[model samples]
Target: MSKHLFSASLLLAISLVVGKSAWGDDNAQSPEPMPPQLEATIKAFEAIGGMHEYRECYGFPSLKFHFFGLKLDSTDADIKKMPVVPFPFAFTSISNSITDLGVAELAKQKNMRALNLVDAQISGQGLAELTHVKDLEVLNLSNSSIQDKGLEALSNFPQLRALRLGNTEVTDDCFVYVSRLKDLEALDLRFTQVQGKKLNELKPCEKLQQLLFSGCPVTDERLQELGKREALEGLDLDYTQVTDNGTKTLENFPNLRNLSLSATKIADQGLEDVGKQKRLQRLYLSGTRVTDEGMSHLGGLDQLEELALSETKVQDAGLAKLSDLKNLNNLKLIRTQVTGTGFDAFSDVPLQTLNLSHAPISDSGMKAIAQIKTLKELTLDHVPLSDEGAKQLASLDNLTLLSLGHSNIGEEGLKSVSQMSKLRVLDLSDTPVSDDSIKELAKLKELRLLYLSGSVITKDSIAQLKKALPNCDIQSDSK
Candidate 1:
């Protein structure tokens, strides 16, 4: 049973035994029983591995249920029992099991604020059932069987703010219905057949701030049509046919804050145009041709907070250019050419999260990284960290999570790791650590989780270490 259900049952048991209400008022009368419809709805939802909990919705506490990737095998009798609830529910990836009948059951939720049917088996006709949900603000039908015919139901939702139709059968013909949603603020058409021309129909959506066409065949000609949307705050064109020429359209969106062009043909010249978006806070350039030259263009984005340059040609020299990004906190440089030589440039940047996995960072790089005292979580998986290099990490006193899996750290390094008294989670998996390191590992009394998997540590040593740190969840494999 779920924790919520168990607590409810326990509360009922206490109420009966003490002759008091569940709210702990002895003199107060018992609360009214749940209505039959509500009870049946709860049972129908729970039968499909759905879980509900009270969460703050708007200002007041409201019940919310979530069903993800679960096969909805509830019988027709159970479906009939699924009545309307004055709450929201998410049915994501409940593939092919939920048909028009299931959607009709969900349609009874007239007050639902958000509905997610991503990758569901519902058809366009099935979506018509949700037309009665007048207050619905968010609707996601991405990767479903929904087509243009089903989108006609969208016109009924005047309060709709965010709509995701990515990877669906909907073509440009669907935008005619989508354009009717004047309140729509976000629209996602990723991996869909809709080209850029039909997006012009969304001119009615003046509140539209976010538009995504990632993995679509959006070309420069079609993308240029969207240049008029100066109010756009976020736009994604990852894996599109857009090139450097298409990047020129970015200059039109002065308010763009979050932009992604990952896996596109955009290069340094395109980045030069991207650099002009001074207000950009989060930028993704992974799996592109971005090099050190392109990195120079991002130096002016002082408001940048998160940057993804993984699987790119970025090197240590490029790090110096990003030092000006004072707000940069989360940076992913996985599979990059960075050796950590220019890490000192961020020593004063207040960076808290850094991932350098699979990078050939040397001992000098580790020393440079140690200078950045603000890091709280660091990932160096599959990196070449020598004993001395690993010892340098002890300087990061604030580090709570550290992943050094598949690294070259040894017994000497394990001794230095024990010095991180504030570390709550540590990953030394697939390393050369052995039973001899148990003495040092036991010193981490504050550790909540420790991973020693794929190490040569014996089962007996792990037991001994566990005895010293009873609260720590130690995971290891016996030699």
Candidate 2:
């Protein structure tokens, strides 16, 4: 079974513990945190409402910051204390705090690869000092005060690869500076005024792999030109007016791997063009006009691994049409009409992860789910899973995670769950598991983390359970 099964589960980790998240990577090499200084610095920045993503870059984890979340009043003097995050603590960002003086200070750092100042009130002339960071490779000036002059000054960084100018004031008249870049791979210009002939001026950018334009005035003609590019791998056209004409153009993209068409005008027929792409792996069609008939076109997508049909028209009958998708390991059916009575739709299917939270699967309907034997994780939040239906899950011995919170599971259900003993994470929060079932939970000494919030557990019961399962990180802190 795939390790991402619990990724869509309603169970959230307590975050205080250093264990596997109930809904994230289970095969953790090591669920380790950064060093004390690095963690403190990140927490300090996060305290000011900065959102960031960290990834391994050249042997060190680098951060990508979004400065739009910061208040407009944030000053260069206050933001100038940019942490000295070197390779091991590499700090990359879609936004950063830098001035002419700040950029001069970065010249000493040799390994800095990416710099950003998004939505910040920095002056356009401040970019003149950016030429000092000679080793920089990625730059993001999205939603900043930078204009044609500041945007063109970026051509000085010959090694720059990924650039984002989304929501910027830079116009089509100044695209030559961007199109001339020799090694640019990923370019994001979403919400910019780049449309019509404005996009064509950058036809020289052939090495582009990912082109993200969500709110730009993109059309099928631009998409058709993109389809002809052999190196383009990812495209995000969410919230755009691109219809089936634009989707059909991508049917023959040789290397397209990830496609996001969320909130678009694509109906059933637009997906027909998507099914023809054999190399596609991840497809996001959330918040669209696609129905069950549209899913029929996806039956031939044998190579697809992840599919998101949330808030679509895919019901039991429509979902049944996807049984032939044997390679499908991840599926998101949130806010749909899947009643959970059609286990046959998943029969013999290698479904490692499945989300049916927003559906109307009753306790009796959950009986149909017993057919999935290879399931390693199961999420039944907001369902009608009572003691009877919860006990039926003991048959799935491979379950490392079982989330039944916000349901009707009581003492008997906990007893039934305790018998399995193989579960590493259990979420009985928001249920009626009372002190009477404390002993039943205590039986599982191997449990890593348990959520008993909103349950009728008492301090005495928590003490007893703590004594019974000394290793478990019990979250009986709530009612």
- Candidate 2: TM-score? 0.78
lDDT of 2 by residue, 51-115 (tens): 44333321101112111111212345434544444443223333345455544444554555666
For residue 377, model 1's alpha carbon misses the true position, in angstroms, by 1.0
For each candidate, the alpha-carbon lDDT, in order, equals 0.75, 0.66
State which candidate has the highest TM-score: 1
Summed backbone clashes in each candidate are: 0, 2
| TM-score of candidate 1 versus the correct structure, residues matched by position | 0.85
Span of ten consecutive residues with least summed lDDT in model 1: 56-65
Clashes of 2: 2
Give the winner by lDDT.
Answer: 1
Return the TM-score for each candidate structure: 0.85, 0.78
